[model samples]
Target: MDRANIIHDLLDWIETHLDQPLLLDNVAAKSGYSKWHLQRMFRSTTGHALGSYIRERRLSQAAQALRSTPRSILDIALQFHFDSQPSFSRAFKKQFGKTPAVYRRTPAQGMTEASPQSSAQQPNYHNESPNLHLLYNGKCTDGKCTQWMGQR
Candidate 1:
């Protein structure tokens, strides 16, 4: 398999495993690459660091849960594997520019994209948006280069 395929597969795997522990060491082991190599390859292909991508995806999924469920903020935070409600709140606020409670109270339409800007060469990602199709900026013979996450 090529580097592109590896990255696409990894993205799908990451999405499906978001609720679990997804530390970089574990992800590197799963990818059969050294941490250094994997980081370099992932950053080169996706224009985002592997760790940052995982974090943003988790935050995005948490945002979806917040909008669609009546679950408590702590529950949502813990569900997404955050260390604690306060940590979750800090990351959430950093990603979405609002507290989870405020975000839940606001209408979805009132929300704006608060994700970090993609690099000049890659497609953009919305850090707290729901139902994103994460595309690998590469050439693929098959249409397996995109991974959809946070789908309702």
Candidate 2:
């Protein structure tokens, strides 16, 4: 397939797997490309790193959940694979210039894009604590977050 087609397929795959842990190695394997090649191609085509694209999409979905549902910020953050509320808030504020709580309260003042559907309709992803810690925070560290070690 062409580069554009490959990128499109990659994006579609990402969207479908938004609720799951999206590791770079896993994505590379799924796309049948080496991690380096996939990163280079994705960046060249999308003007953003693959990791950045995934992070942005996850944050966008979390924003939707924040605004459209009564779910707690922590639940929304965890649902989108964020390690903690603080880290999620930092990224959310960086991206939308407002915290999730603030955005939920006044969505119009933040990014105004419409969500594809209500977050309520999404399946309950009852992921284990270990998996959540590994995917979101990197290390367990006695199950106490001493610092924001995950991606911003």
Candidate 3:
């Protein structure tokens, strides 16, 4: 097909096969484009370049491992085909602000928290006028903005 379609297919293939080593030649052959040509097109169209996209995808997987899996950093790195934990950590930090361990410390990290079950629990939305939108700087219950609107 076209160049963009080829690259998108290649990216999808790479993401689906993240646990394996993704080599340039292998990718080139898969997309029926030579290494140099595909690399150039991939860099231009995606704005990320091939290597960055793979590393970013790996880092995202590593982050999920940090959150959901009991595997250690080294184990996760090895699983993602990174040579060492340090390399994985460096790449992870580059992609996301925090290190894997820091992101995993959920209660202390505050990355996730209890959800607000209803509109009453949140100060941003109101219960009485359900589904209403308000832009008040002060507490919303006062109806001060409504009064101001009426006067004008």
Q: Write model 1 residue lDDT over 13-123, tens digit each, in one string.
A: 887798899989999999999999999988876666789889888898788888878999999999989999999999888877789999989886755534333556543
Off by over 4 Å in 2: 107-111, 117-152
Using alpha carbons, what is the TM-score of model 3? Answer: 0.67
lDDT of 3 by residue, 72-130 (tens): 88998999999888887777666555677876674435232111113353221110111
Whole-model lDDT values for every prediction: 0.74, 0.66, 0.57
Q: Give per-residue lDDT, candidate 3, residue 59.
A: 66
Which portions of model 3 miss their true places by more than 4 Å? Answer: 107-152
Can you write out model 2's per-residue Cα lDDT over 55-124, one digit (the tens) per residue? 7778777877777789999999999898999999998888767778877788355333534422443321
Query: What is candidate 2's local distance difference test score?
Result: 0.66
Between candidates 1 and 3, the TM-score winner: 1
Evaluation by TM-score, superior candidate among 2 and 3: 2
Give RMSD (Å) of candidate 2 vs. truth. Answer: 13.6
RMSD of each: 7.4, 13.6, 15.8
